[model samples]
Target chain A: MSDEVVTPLSHEECWQMLREEEFGRLAFRLVDEVHITPVNYAVDHDTLLFRTAAGNKLLSVAMGAEVAFEIDRYDDHHARSVVVRGGARILHEDEEHRADNVPLRPWVGTPKYNVVEITPRVVTGRAFRLTRPWLHLTLDGLGQE
Target chain B: MSDEVVTPLSHEECWQMLREEEFGRLAFRLVDEVHITPVNYAVDHDTLLFRTAAGNKLLSVAMGAEVAFEIDRYDDHHARSVVVRGGARILHEDEEHRADNVPLRPWVGTPKYNVVEITPRVVTGRAFRLTRPWLHLTLDGLGQE
Candidate 1:
């Protein structure tokens, strides 16, 4: 009772949407297990920037890990998603100073001493429209069908 | 200007919250690149159920791929996130029939020939509260802060 069309978004559209969102989920592998963390980040140029204190996320980056970052939005009728896959590296002292100038800040109140950057190698996005079956039924009852 | 306190959620609390959400982002590695897709899914006895047609997600599960599924909710003041690390597998014909009994449905309204199940090996979550520095400034101007 639901019908919708799924469409692939362009590269520019995906990047633009990514820049517009403030939060995303970062996925990585640690200790032979995959882990995902939701983080507040800012985009600078082509790199994604976020702060981290001492935690699994920091540990994974310290080991030079490959990660996936994703952000999405959905409503009853529409949905959009963007995914970025890349390697994460802790910024050097000089780079951190430059990043500090970029106004990158973490939502957590605690001070995050390290700045990590994910240089996305592949970015893809999908957009789709959905028609709820129940909604359709309701409309049919109202003689709108 | 964001200041927030992040609290680690307990296992029970995380699971409870996971069952409450209807949609999540699924992360997996395909062709050596990590990719994530937003999927509408349902929970069945601690397992995540979702549908996919002929796509990378279906192909990945057919290969017995490890995946990470994440769901989250956020507002101006608080955010909660849950991540499930698991292996994804396509249901066998018999299992497929059983899954049809579950309340699992796709949001895209497309005909998904394959039903996939993700058996989570580890689940974790975090909750945080943020006080926007800008909001504080506005409140201060009104003599409320």
Candidate 2:
């Protein structure tokens, strides 16, 4: 058996994963504290687009703080995660119209009028095989059964 | 039907959800940038515990940075998210023994010697109904047949 359990994902694979998944967690700095919130996002070209209400997320973008967005999926045997670190900014006027072209929508019924974009500076990901120590052994799988 | 679609989770409920889940994203600051990474964790009393190799996550704990950890689950109809904000620190010497009592384990085959604890200052959560615009209507539901 191969001893390698973790492998690095390529840039193309990272973007493909981002494009396929609509939900992810967004991490941003608000003053000295770091906050992570789940968000629904869409991949637009090389940037990520999402809508938000007027709150700390918008405030953080206004303050020009760096943000990290992550998405992952795991089954019983394997897992993959992609992280994007970048500067977030709120879209305005014509940019808001551009955002409308994407399929992004608020998950809740609340009105989230502010559209934000994340321009990634660093994108990295990893795929790893999980070790299931609790897997049950079955006699049927053996020749004795 | 009532128009209320989003509801806040009680403190007890938040803790219950945290206790039930073993995987979540941990967000912390390194310098001015915020980073998010998925981790497998276990709830130990009022704190959260997980093991990691020597890396940026451990470095953030050593620097006494406030971290945000989040876990969420969503289906086609509903979604629930819980966020925990706390200060993370590395467990040393005998403290590592306490972590061993928990079910926490590294997902990969590599060895993770350092155990870290997150002492939460604020824990909050919300449950919301999802608006699935893509749901197809069936005549059977209307009793047309």
- The backbone clash count of each candidate, in order, is 1, 0
Candidate 1 lDDT tens digits, B31-98: 54555668777778888888777465445543586788898877667778888888898877688865
Docking class of 1: acceptable
lDDT of 2 by residue, A39-128 (tens): 888889999998777675445443467899999888667888999999888877678876766667777888656778999999999988
> What is every candidate's C-alpha DockQ against the true complex, given to 2 decimals?
0.33, 0.39
Where is model 2 chain B poorest over a 10-residue stretch in terms of lDDT? B136-145
CA deviation > 4 Å runs, candidate 2: A1-3, A55-63, A135-145, B1-3, B55-63, B134-145
Which stretches of model 1 miss by more than 4 angstroms? A1-4, A54-58, A61-63, A134-145, B1-4, B55-58, B61-63, B134-145
The most accurate candidate by DockQ is: 2
Clashing pairs in 1: A109-B4
Q: Pick the candidate with the highest TM-score.
A: 2
TM-score of 2: 0.87
lDDT of 1 by residue, A1-145 (tens): 1333888889999998776776788877664455667877778899998877846444554347678888887766777888898888877778887566554556667754677888988889888886545443222221100
